[model samples]
Target: MSGYGVVIPAFNAATTIAETLRSVVAQSVKPDAVIVVDDGSTDDMAAVINALNLKVRLLRQENTGPGSATTRGIAALSTPFIATLDADDLWLPTKIEEQLAHFRRFPQVAGVFTHWRNFHHDRPDAPEAVTVPGWSRSTMMIRREVFDAVGPIVDPPGGRGEMIDWIARAREAGLVLDMLNEALTLRRIRPGSLSYGRDAARDRGYLEVARLAMQRRARNRTEPS
Candidate 1:
């Protein structure tokens, strides 16, 4: 209910991770811990982290995808709440403060997500207007119970859709999830990022996630009350 930490899943994010961590450090509510799990990054992530002079734990592993990296970061934290941030995103100074306030207001919700806007990495000065409540992992502040009840971010084959599966699974498990209307995150839209370009593999992951969700729904429908 009180303590929270930050987990960042990185894959060759050395160029952008320092700024991401800076955003965390700028939060009004300081995190209990911060961990970055590098998923087989061939970059000098260690050097970048060291030079930043910020308190961050760096963990390295083979290329397992962002979901696995995120779960690893989550497991390494010893806090009641876990907030995730992508290596290429930035959180406004009040991001954590606003989320913690939402928790106090809801009292019973398992997770809180805020709206976000995307900005081109090269044109950081030209951020788009905040449009909608984005139920993204980068915008989420969740209780550890959500994972304990549901599970870690699904590692479907390929690029994206794992978070979609994660959110769906959380809902199926009857967890109380809510999102704030306030935009608190700035997503960097850059080339070479996982979500930057769509491909067949990404689509395949989507199909797999959808199938799994449908199967879960069917199972729930058949289960006796």
Candidate 2:
């Protein structure tokens, strides 16, 4: 099997890191290696990773935010493909197997993203599926070279906007982006989630990404002839 690596950037995630690790460890198509980047958590998150005894490469750095931690993790990977999972999220057993098959089927595809189910942390109800447009980072798997070409994931001023900016850049670079249309991951919604209480900020973040995408499109349009 061709190898793929997983990067899990964590911060103050002691409450959920174990489950995330277990899900990765249980993947039907196991990762070539798993790396957990502990982004300066002032908690027992490191102890949690140690107690799990998972076969994951661990890297610790001062709190530089998720984009920086993700960049560090990707730089440390020796595989051709890379996948990311937030500490509060999990992958289904077939997530890797399914996405890997998709990549193989579409060799031209530089990155693939899947639909996700969102659930309240303590709720048993089925998760709500969020229909995202075009390329999104909430559910993505990408070739390592894509990052190498487009550069590191940028820290978009604030919030989860950096994800959108990265995707926009990939699209601008003529990278083929596709949706697997399957619920490969579960993104948990909790009390203090940045997405939960910061409505105005989140909306602003979305607009910033939209503006960036529009600017890229306009540039592409006027470049030739």
Candidate 3:
């Protein structure tokens, strides 16, 4: 075991998951294990993954949100360190290697992330590569201990801001985090993706995330330290 593993939470991601898995397998520092939680995917997601004959462990469950799926995936991984990736995202060949390097350099930090660029799923070839802004679920690599400390990701009612809630909680717990300036992940911009369209559900999710975050802040302020 390399003491490193990956957890991917997928939902009807058959269209792009193979390429995403390829990106992980092609990493310079290959993960020791990869676990994928199929969050009640209606598509042929499982078949697609199986056809690839890749080194992945697939678990199926009811239609839970990404946060629940992510929690399940993390629990199934035994590695001391874990990295997460979305089923539709791609990482550079050296993404894991670079993150591991950052960990070794900043031993005090709880996690390491890298910058990323957005690429249209249809035009995968034309992406400019390496853009501003990082620190997404697909870019975070952290110790298993931090995850246990933080607990499972809180899946909101609308199901879009769970990661946002989890990160805020991690920060509230005082765990130090770091992000590399170099871009190593490519976020796929797809029209049918959950985060693509602005709808009532997404808006409700955003509001709930904000409300929960604020609520946490209030509780923290009141806690007897």
Candidate 4:
């Protein structure tokens, strides 16, 4: 088995899935296994994946939201190291190689994230850096044991803003999150993306994450440190 595994949570990502898969397959240090979780996509995403035949695994499940799909994929991983790449995102050929090196150099870090360029499908020339506090899923490579230690991602009620909740839980578990400071991924920003249209929901998610992180910090201070 490959020492590393990648889990991709996809939903109707026909437009970009092929490119994403190719990017991973073409990596200098390919993952031992790559899993694509088809989260109840109504489109031809299945067909697209089947056509690749790149030795990657595909898991199909009913629409359970990205957080749950990701959780399931993490459970299915058999490697010591696991990374996440959304189906709509593209990774550099050296993404995995760089992350593995970082993990080796810093064994105590539970996860590593890289800088990424953001591009809109319609506007490819105007690629910009994605700068958000905390972490972005597209850039993170995590140790499988981190999940076992912290617990699986908890799906929030109403199936909204679950990613925020997952990240909060990780920080609470004292996982050392490190940034590689290299652009290893490209995130596609669609017109009506959650970062754009769902401003209110995104803000609420950010607030929740900040509050939990602060509370955890306060509690840590009160402890015998």
Off by over 4 Å in 3: 125-130
Segments in model 1 whose C-alpha atoms lie over 4 Å from true places? 127-130
Which residue pairs collide, candidate 2? Answer: none
Worst 10 residues of 1 by lDDT: 123-132
- Check candidate 3 and list the clashing pairs: none
Q: Model 1 over residues 1-225: C-alpha lDDT tens digits?
A: 488999999988888998999999999999999999989989898799999999899988999989999999998988999999999999999999988988888888999999888888887634456657878879999988778788778788876888999999888778899988888898889987888877886678899999999998899899999
Give lDDT: candidate 1, residue 4: 94
For 123-162, candidate 4 gives per-residue lDDT tens digits of 6624455634326667788888887887766544444566
Tens digit of per-residue lDDT, candidate 2, span 81-194: 899988888788898888889998989998888877777788752745564332444467899899999898765555567787887788777889888877777878898765
Clashes of each: 0, 0, 0, 1
TM-score of every prediction relative to native: 0.96, 0.89, 0.95, 0.85
Q: Which candidate is the best by TM-score?
A: 1
Instruction: Give all candidate RMSDs, comma-separated.
Output: 1.2, 2.4, 1.5, 3.1
Per-residue lDDT value at 78 in model 1: 82
Error of 4 at 66 (Å): 0.5
lDDT of all the models against the reference? 0.88, 0.81, 0.88, 0.79
Candidate 1: what lDDT? 0.88
Model 1 RMSD vs true structure: 1.2
Error of 1 at 146 (Å): 1.6
